[model samples]
Target: MDFFTAQEQARRQTGRLVVLLVLAVLALIAVTTLVVAVVLYMAGIGGAHSQPQPTLQGMMALLSWELLASVAVGVVALVGLGGLFKRRQLRRGGKAVAEALGGREINLNTRDSDERRILNVVEEMAIASGTPVPSVYVLEEEGINAFAAGYQPGDAVIGMTRGAIRQLSRDELQGVVAHEFSHILHGDMRLNIRLVSLLHGILLIGLAGGMLLRSLRFRRMGGNKRDNSAALVMGLGAALMLIGYAGTFFGNLMKSAVSRQREYLADAAAVQYTRNPQGIGGALVKIGANAKGSALAAPQTAEFSHLLFSQGIKQGFSRFMATHPPLKTRIQRVMPGWDGQFVALKPAPGVTVEPDQSPQSTAGAGGRASVRDNVRASLENAGAPHAGSMATVLSAASVQMAIGAMGQPDQRHVAQAQTVLSALPAALKTAAHEPYTARALIYAMLLSENDAQRQHQLAVLENIALPDVFTELHTLMADVARLDVQLRLPLIELTLPALTSLTIEQAQHFRLCMERLIHSDGHVSLFEWTLYQLLLSHLSEHHGGAENLTLQACERECQRLLSVLAAAGLEQGLESVQERASEMAHALHAAQQVLPFELAAVEDADDMQALSLAVERLRRLKPLQKSLLLQSMARCIEHDGRIRPAEAELFRAIADMLGCPVPPLLGGGTEEQAVLAE
Candidate 1:
């Protein structure tokens, strides 16, 4: 499915979920009212004093309208409260989900070869997909399962089972990660989270019922309570239990209905993305052949079964409760006409140690080389253009089309990613691998070519950063300073996952330090502002709040950002600024035919503050608006028919800020080399 369609589907699914939840709530309220009335009648609340007996008709008469209303209200509150609580608990995004499943975050600096290999595959995929590399975690389960979880691209995390890491080859692993990426790209994570939380809420009634029943078993009924009272309490407990299970039954039906088809789409997308059916299909075949069969051993797997690349938990009800399609059916979809037989696979022999391939190795079947062959794959991938297959000028009629092109994963991207990954500097690549070195590497990029500015920035760092980090900064300064204009942003992109590992306080301090350094020379270059904006926008989780603004609502912000683009493009001494501005205006006008407006003239600002504010506001724009914004930005930059280094950097920074990790323009290799040489 395309990006906008997927987004629309997610919205529709949410609506369906709400309707289902409401129906379930109503059903629960009705059942609870009946149970309450039955218990009360049995307890003799409706019996005559002389008769000492309650008939069914008498009980029906005793069930007041007020009682039913009260029960309905209570039921709604319980379900609503449970959902809200669970949502809050999961609000931390994919990391929380991973942690709940007993996943351990992979340290960037780990020497373990398998961990390093996993990081390589994830990095390549992120670069290929034009997204920030997500945090990766490893679950200790022996099942061959994996998942991607997050509310958005930035907070997303990729999780793998110990079994997945051990059993799947490099190619198979890529395919599985691609499958999870499909979920991430298609906006399935948020809906999945909602489903899990809402299902939990529905199950809360059952849990409460079970608790009451368990309590009744322990509480003695002999002291002061009449037989009917004890029996009524038991009946109430029994009724609650029944109602709770009923809620679960309905919730499972909804979950299955919502989840099963998406699994099929994701599987298809995975094969399409890698252009290698064997990768994902092989993984599935292994799952079937193995005893564990892609089943997660974690207790929490049942909650997020829909998010997994394969079924994470066993479904008791074949077609009704299964979050994913049957393994054989899924395998056949990817690899058609497969006999219903499992393949017996084994680990590669003598692959006990880390591969030692130089940074330049891009050769393998489908760019799937063993770990021993491509130690620098991660960095090289970062250096390459993200979407080299498409011409630098992305073609789109609307914002969604533009974003769809940006977000879609393709086989061409894999080749270009490998090419880019192979060309990175060894030292720069090494620095991006470890947490401490990664920070220093970024500082090195910020350090000026001017000796005075460089020293001033270093002094700010020394005062704010720890002594060790400062020392590392000094050590890596020479290598970082040697980096050319084109490679700088890619290096920063490489550092993002490690930077994300920083504490909130550390991130804040890092943000502050960066601001002081950028302004230290008494001026902010466009490149500096762009770089700072990209770093700070992503590094700070709540950078611009939500992207909830309609295109009409964010008109001013869009104009301001467009003005910045116009100014940046014109700054390169292009002959006619007006002509370029006219071209930009035309692009904006064409892209946003729905909201026709001319480009507002650039308003001067004393500092980069205007551009920063423009970006902050632009973050609030909806996806379609962002598409128009990107198209307009690209038009402004490409008016000269060539993307210069400064323009390319600005473009990348803008894309990253908008949560689109645009690959390096001009497709790396000789083109980038020529720019660096210039």
Candidate 2:
């Protein structure tokens, strides 16, 4: 689907919501008006001595109008509140996406060129597609699945499950990635996130109404039991609230319908992005045949299923509430002849499996015929010097992974992160700080993993060399917390790694810690849990068997944690951690604190100051800090309703002071983003 189509769909959905709310308001007003009319009509009893009073009738008419007007205002207010809350959610989600993806540069420490190649491919595609390269994440899941998430192209992220890397062929993986990219490029992601926020807001109304009704019922039952008039009012309030809830149900159905339609478009867009339906189509066929398929047992799956490559979640019991179209319809769309009957596709006879040497996709870039040449020779090249690089970024995932291209990342993503960090450009390799780059990297890395696996990975690292890698490991965790509006689950998991060294019993203790934490937390973060579980699988080499009761124990522990957090007093917050972390004053921490910031001589940095005055102004710490802020500032020029171009410049200067090199902006990707065309 194109941008225009997405807009039309959003507009229609939004309009439908408004219309329904309006009707609800009208119904409420009419009901109230009728009830009042009947009451007033009875009050003016017809008796032998009864006299007509025009003034009484006129007063009642005026009261009825006032009541209708008030209800109209209330309904509009509800809708406005939804939009306001939704807008805030969109802002926060967008920021999290940017922080997770934007600051990542290629980490030079990657064991093999596989990740470097992944970075290069992402870069090439971004250049070709005329957009900035998106952030890439590797999932630790052994199952093949990928997803794209973010509100817009500037902030979009592409994450793949570990299973995808282990199982899917290069072309097949590319197909999955391309489908997600299409969702990002075509604006499906923004709509999906909006749906989540808006639904939460709208649902609050029904919840409030229910609470109000319950309160009235309790109030009337107290000492006012025999007050017939109050009882009548209480009953009327309950009926009004019940009527309000009916509207909420309709609104929910509409929102779900909107979500389902976008899923279809994303599927279509994925095919368009890859230009190879069979790559994704074939993968789907395999998933359908596999018993596990795309089903994720992780509790977080339900929260983000709409953003997945396939249906990994469900919302409510009804079919309309489902986020994605049925599997049969999806398969038929991609592969027209695919029968619902599962027919296992057989590899051709006598096919010899060989090392992958040739490029499967990359749209000819780094190949015999690249996307750059294919498009540059056409009339589409608009003199953008960096176009080639960006295109590689987009087409990167579509490339087939050769045996040489695949040096599998450790299932423990924290360990893999240490490896990823080592591969970074020298100037960008900053040690982990709470609000800095490590947090971002962890988000990108974990975006690729599910919750249970994430927990397991953290646990494994804790048992392995966790205390040794505090800066990177812990900061990575902070990033997860920052992105989530909730507490850092990994922090709770981080409590168990022995500072001295691992003992046989220490490892067992770590396993128990995971079990206790999970049982306490109740439901684990689906993505985080997936990562931890994967780590457990990888740790099978060091530990005992892969599955026994470790995961089960963790699940039990999570329930306990959730109940504890609910109780509130037992939970620790950041202040305690900050005080504890004071002892972690290593070389990196010292360097961050003591280094004298370096500044470049700006020819015209200050217009208000004379040359001497300008020099004085440049020496100020605020100016330098502001300059440092610019380097990491997102593409968003306006944040929190304030313009910050000057601040952006300052951020750039400060980052340079800290010796962090900034990347050149890659603008306007062709073929995908029309915004880039401008």
Candidate 3:
């Protein structure tokens, strides 16, 4: 599955959801219209039927247009408002989902072995998958379930039940994490959120009806009973209760169909991702035998049942309403030719299943090796530019390879990720593991090299920095300053989860401090601006910058983005400016072959302001459009046959802004070598 194509498909699913929702609303309108007509007849607002009984046709004809219209309007408004209100509540994205489910985030510095192991699995998977590591949450429930939730990669969170953490082996845990990551990569999360919100809106009617019925019963018991008006109210409440449940029945059918298909896809993807069916297959077997049986006990589980890894509630008598496919069917899909028998696992106390032979550990093996060896090999493969070598451009193919690796790492990329992690300075790595030190570390990264500018940056930090933050800053500044430019962005990526642990007020203040530092020098360096914007964009709890953008509507912004990139290539090249301009024109022409795009003029070649605006607009582009844009930017930058660290940083910054987390280009291989490595 191509990442861009998968995202496009997800967008189409949202459209399908809209069509389905409209049908559901119409159904509600029809049901409510009939119910209201009956209510009126019972209330004697229509002519009293004292003398003659009306036929079924007469009853249909007696439905007043005025009353029907009122009920239709009322149902539409109620359903629409309920859905919109729920969606609004969820605008905070993955965090909201996690909180709603009572998930407690596991701190990166956690001491518990199981929690730490889960974190390791998640981090490695994140690195291998080329996405920023998501924040991890633990549901206190003992059910063996997990889920990935978020609208976009930046704010995504991973939630696992305590049962999953304790009961599964490392490989089994890996399989579960990989399965959740597939959901993230395949674009199911946003759709899942929409389904939950829409179903809630539909379910609200039934709840309201029940409330009305209960109130009527209470009234009857208290005083007013035998009168016609009281009888009418009782009849109306009972009718609404019935209609409300009818709506719920249909809504669950829709939810079940959608949820079940995605579960199969996720299971298959997990097997492909790990290249190990037994890992995930073993997890299923365990769930089958375990007493807990992956059934969640949380009050909110019913609402989020479709999002969990396994059936969170009873499947009920009807299979059509089950959120997940049966265990046997799912297992067969991952492991064909299996006999229809399940062996329930019962590991000895304090023991977990270990594979007969780990696929990643063998010499000459094409799959996973021992974690320590993988780490060591990756460190050995890490490369640096030769001193005084000024080649700063890469070939077109190299550019394509780099962008292609974004959010879709192969074995080679996974190896390089290990190297990137290994390459981190020990001090910096420590700081990234804690919120306060992580804040100090970022401040240190943004501190200017020049003495006067550095002092001014320090002044900005002094106002907001806790005493401990300043002490940590003083301790870590020199090492961060001496760090390689290629390592800077990765370090920032590493610290994101820890930084996310901050309270909203602290995060806001952190943003303020970052902005102050960037503007303190009276000139925003490209690196400074990029780092500040990227940090604020991801860290702000309420930032929804890309929510409204569409590729079809943002054509000019696309052109502006490519033009800025083309112009940057032109200015930064060692060749004559005109010659570089010609090279960029060729690159832009190549981009047109892949996407419907064109460059307007080279006059804006050095337009820094245009570049910033372009970044903002392009952030809203759909996943496929973003892929094309990233490829286009790479083509333009690599036109001169050299790619400077600064240009590479800018390229990565733009991709990250669009919610595509890119690892260090070719694992920090030198320009010519990295191109060859690609």
What is the C-alpha lDDT profile of model 3 across 108-199, one tens digit per residue?
Answer: 87767677777767776776665767899999987788888887777789999988888887668777887888788778887898888887
How do the residues 1-678 of candidate 1 rate in per-residue lDDT, one tens digit apiece? Answer: 666457556766777789878887887888799888877766766552213665677667657799899898778887888898998888777888999999999986667777777877887787767677788999988888998988777778999988888888777888898888888877787788878889888788778777777787777778675556666667787887788888888788778777888888888888777767888888899999888878887888888888888878777856778888888899999989678899777853222323222122222343343432243244244544342112233222222322445646665565445554555566667678666788788777777888887877888778887677778887878766655565566567678888888888887777787777877888988778777777776665552355566767767766776656656655445568577666656545443444546666555633478767767777766666665667667765555455556666677678778755554443434433332222
The top-ranked prediction according to lDDT is 3
- All candidates' TM-scores? 0.86, 0.44, 0.87
Q: List the pairs of residues colliding in candidate 3.
A: 360-368, 360-369, 361-369, 361-370, 392-642, 392-643, 393-641, 393-642, 393-643, 394-642
lDDT assessment of candidate 2: 0.41
Task: Please identify model 1 stretches exceeding 4 Å from their true place.
Answer: 46-54, 225-229, 349-404, 521-523, 543-548, 574-595, 605-613, 661-678
Give candidate 2's root-mean-square deviation (CA, Å). Answer: 19.7
In model 1, what is the error at residue 578, expressed in angstroms?
7.3
Task: Select the stronger candidate by lDDT from 1 and 2.
Answer: 1
TM-score of 3: 0.87
Select the stronger candidate by TM-score from 1 and 2.
Answer: 1
Say which candidate scores most in TM-score: 3
